[model samples]
Structures are given as C-alpha cells and as structure tokens.
Target: MLILECPYCGVAADETELSPGGEAHLVRQGPGSSDQELESYLFGRKNPKGVHFERWRHSYGCGKWFHAARCTMTLEVFATYSAQTPVPPKNVINAIKAKRPDWEGWT
Candidate 1:
C-alpha cells in the first residue's frame, strides 16, 4: 500500500482510492484536423521507462483529475498536483532528477 498526497485535498490517500487515468497533459491540436490525425492523437500515449506524467483520479475523494510524477520501472511516486497546476509534464521529471539524482538513479 502506498500513500498518495493529493494537492487539492491536502491529505495522503491509499492507492486503492485512486484510478489510473492514463497519460497527462497531452498537447491539444489546433482545429481542422483529419480523421487519421485525430485517431493518432487519441491513441498515442507516453509509455516511457523512467519518470512519466500520469493522470490519476481520486475515486474515493474529490473525484477530480490530478497529475502525478511516477516511475514506470519502480512504481514510485515523487509528487502529485491538481489538474489546474501550470507545471509542464516533462519538466517534472527533469526537476526531480536535478534535485535528487539518487532517488531517480542515473538519469
């Protein structure tokens, strides 16, 4: 069991209370896109190995979407924030590695 800190709720929650909401903060395309483009956009996901920005829903609490910086290999969570947070997804990983390289390991 892991405790997830919710930025909005200001409390740590059990992992069971959350649902994996897939990739987070996907860049939106401009209008006038073709079918193939829309299909590719909807299907694409960042299935990376190291740190990744993932969407998670607090099913048992506020029921709002939140962003989490997680490790795909170790399944460790470094930080969590509300959907409205302005931080870029890619920057989260880079910032973590910059602060604590040992925690992430040889980035």
Candidate 2:
C-alpha cells in the first residue's frame, strides 16, 4: 500500500488513487530525429532496481500529473515535484546519493 502525497491537493493518497504514467522527463524524439532516436524514445526504458523517477497522475483527487523520485527496490519515496520539471530536483538527487553512495548520478 503505497501512500503518495499529492502536491496539488495536499492529500496523502493511496496507490489505488493514482495512475502510473511511465518514466518521467523523457526527451521526445520527433520528425527531425533519426530512426534510432525515435525508437529509443518510444521504447527505451530504465528498468533499474534502485532509485528511479516516474510520473503519476492523481486520478481520484486533484486529477493532475506529478513527478516522483522513489526507490524501486525498497519502495521509498525520495521526493515529489511538478510534472513540468524536465529533471528531478537537486535535493532529490542528493538524497538518493546519500542513500546509495555508489550511484554515479541520474541519467
């Protein structure tokens, strides 16, 4: 039972109230890009076992999409930020590094 804090509505929502929107901050590859770029954009994914960034929509509450930095292994949420952000915030990155010192950085 994952409890996600909704930044918009200030509500702590259960997993059932949210919708997973896949990887966050993906660089979209369109017409001007090469075939490989397009393929990567469409299918390339990070199936990491550790800290990861994701997009989630609060379906049963504010009905807004937001970004979340969490650990895939331990199910620990590092932080949440606006979906409009192109990358996870610096603090979130630092937090992950604190937990996993060996981590190089978020790609």
Candidate 3:
C-alpha cells in the first residue's frame, strides 16, 4: 500500500486517506496563451517510469495539500514538501539522487 507523510500535519497516511492530484509543478496555461500551449499544458504530461513528483491531498486527515517525490516503479517515497514550493527542494533532490544515481532530475 502506498503511504505518504503529510508535511503539514505530520501524519503518515495511506493512499486511501489521500487524493492524488496528478503531476506537480505544472506551468499553468492562462489567457493570451496559444492553443498549442494550452493543449500541451493540459495533455503533455510525462508518464515516467522512475522518479516522479506529484501533488497529494490529505483529505481523510488534515485536509491539506502537499507535494511528494517518489519512485513510480517501486513506490518508494523519497520525500514530501509543501505544495507552494515551485520546485523540488535540495534535500529532496539529493535524496532522489542518492537512491537513483542516474535520475535525470526535475525538468
């Protein structure tokens, strides 16, 4: 079972207690954006087999949202951080690197 610790509430919650919010740190397309940009933003998502960053909402617990760095293939959670973070923190990146030396890193 997939489990993640809520950074806000510090609760280790299972997947059932949380809500997956798709890929994290997406560049949102807004008004004045071209059709291609909008379409790409909506559909051009990376379904990588390795390290992935994603958003999660602790619905059954504190009801707060956060971001998590994890391995999609092994389900190994590297770290969790605030959703407001624009990019993965240094520690989280280092953690991923320590485990996955060849990880291309966040784009």
Candidate 4:
C-alpha cells in the first residue's frame, strides 16, 4: 500500500488512512470570470501522464490537507508539502529532479 506523510501532523499515513483531494495548485475561477472559464475550473483537469502534483488529506489522522508530488505512471511519491501555497516549493521541485532526472519541470 502507498504511504503518505502528513506535513501538518507529522504522521506517515497509509493510503487507507488518507483521502485523495484531486489535482493540486488549481486556480479557482471567481465571480468576474466568464462562463467558459468557470466551467473549465469546475471540470477541466490536465490529467497528465508523467510527473503530477495532487492533494491528499490525512482523513484518519490529523484531518489536514497536503500536496504530494508523484509520478502518474510509476506512482512514485517524490515529496509532500503543505497545502497553503499555490505552487510546489523549491525543495519539493529539487527532490523530484533528483529522483527523476528527465523531468521537464512543472509550473
């Protein structure tokens, strides 16, 4: 089973103890946005094949949300970080690069 570390609570939680919160770092469309923009925000997802970032909540532990950088094909977790930011931090990016030398980068 997959294991994820919760940054907030410092707990290494098993996959069964967590809940997937979908792709992370998505920009939310608000009131002044067009219908298409709002629609895309509501449903559109890149769903890429390689390196991906996602949100994971420690459902059975601290009940906090965190971000995880992982490989979609291999299901290899590179790193996990706090969910308060809009983008992956530099350390997380570096960790991914160390693990995956061919990574094209994420932004």
- Find the candidate with the highest lDDT and give its number: 3
lDDT against true structure, model 2: 0.89
Considering summed lDDT, which 10 consecutive residues are worst modelled in model 4? 1-10
TM-score-best of 2 and 3: 3
**Ranking, lDDT, top scorer first:** 3, 4, 2, 1
Error of 1 at 10 (Å): 1.6
Candidate 1 lDDT tens digits, 1-107: 65678778876878899888888777555579877777767897768887777778888998877888877777778778778754544566566687558654322
lDDT of 4: 0.92
lDDT of 2 by residue, 1-107 (tens): 77889878889989999999999999999989999999999999998998788999999999999988888988998888788788888888988888889976888
Per-model tally of clashing residue pairs: 0, 0, 0, 0
| lDDT scores in order | 0.74, 0.89, 0.94, 0.92
- Estimate, for each residue in 42-64, the C-alpha lDDT of model 4 and write its tens digit: 99997989899999999998899
Better of 1 and 2 by lDDT: 2
Off by over 4 Å in 3: none
Model 4 segments more than 4 A misplaced: none
Q: What digit string (tens of lDDT, one per residue) describes model 3 on residues 1-107? A: 99999999899999999999999999999899999999999999988998999999999999999999999999999999999888889999999999999998778
